[model samples]
Target: MFTSILVPVDGSEHARKALSVACQLARQEGSTLHLLHIPEELSHETTLVWGIGAIAIEASREERENAGKQVISRAAEAAREQGVTEVETVIGQGDPARTILSEAKRRGVDAIVMGSRGLSDLQGFVVGSVSHKVSHTAECTVITVR
Candidate 1:
């Protein structure tokens, strides 16, 4: 039984399901659930270089943070409802896959649970799935929920 589970939530339906599963496992094992949301990083230089309009850039940043907060908050609330008291919430800013794996390693978590589809449009067309990359690169176990 995993003792420390790290769940990365993105407020998506798929991710919420993963959170539900993680909560159940955590409760059954009497383990801790670490809920993580990787905030989208937006550098001013990148915005200018990409030729994104000022208004659009601001909107993107706001949307990213807003969505991230909602994701973490909802996951935390669900964990509480499932009787998981030992839950931690973390917000990261960077690439989703890399940040999730990094947070898992940093926390020395026993396992990682995340959604198959994240906040990216080209996720499916990538060389490797985010979950696959995390599973392969992480030192611990990774569970990907569809």
Candidate 2:
């Protein structure tokens, strides 16, 4: 039983699936779900899950942050819809893996549930995925949804 679960959302289908999994865990244990979005500079236009529009690579930092907000908001809504009453949203800035780990520590979350891959699929294939890094480094339990 996790007390708090951190779910990093990037508007990717994988992330959404992870959120759904986290919701189930939260519902079972009466846990809190922390939906975190870390704004990344995309290299290409990519359509998001949760009905969020595509994010262009040329978009500004502000635009990316706005999108990140939407990502967390939508993830929280989805978690709530799945019967997770205690849901929190966060928009973070920095390297995705570091930010996620930092948030987990800051919130004292017992576990992290995140997508195995995010919007940076190509980059991750080359340099390792955020979930991979976080899972390796984090002290808590990690469940990565493919």
Best candidate, lDDT-wise? 2
Model 2 segments more than 4 A misplaced = none
Clashing pairs in 2: none
TM-score of predicted model 2? 0.98
Candidate 1 global lDDT: 0.75
Give a tens-digit lDDT track for model 1, residues 58-140.
55677667656766787798889989989999998787779988899899999998877654435445556667778779999
What ranges in model 1 sit over 4 Å off? 41-58
lDDT of 2 at 51: 86
Cα error, residue 28 of model 2, in Å, equals: 0.3
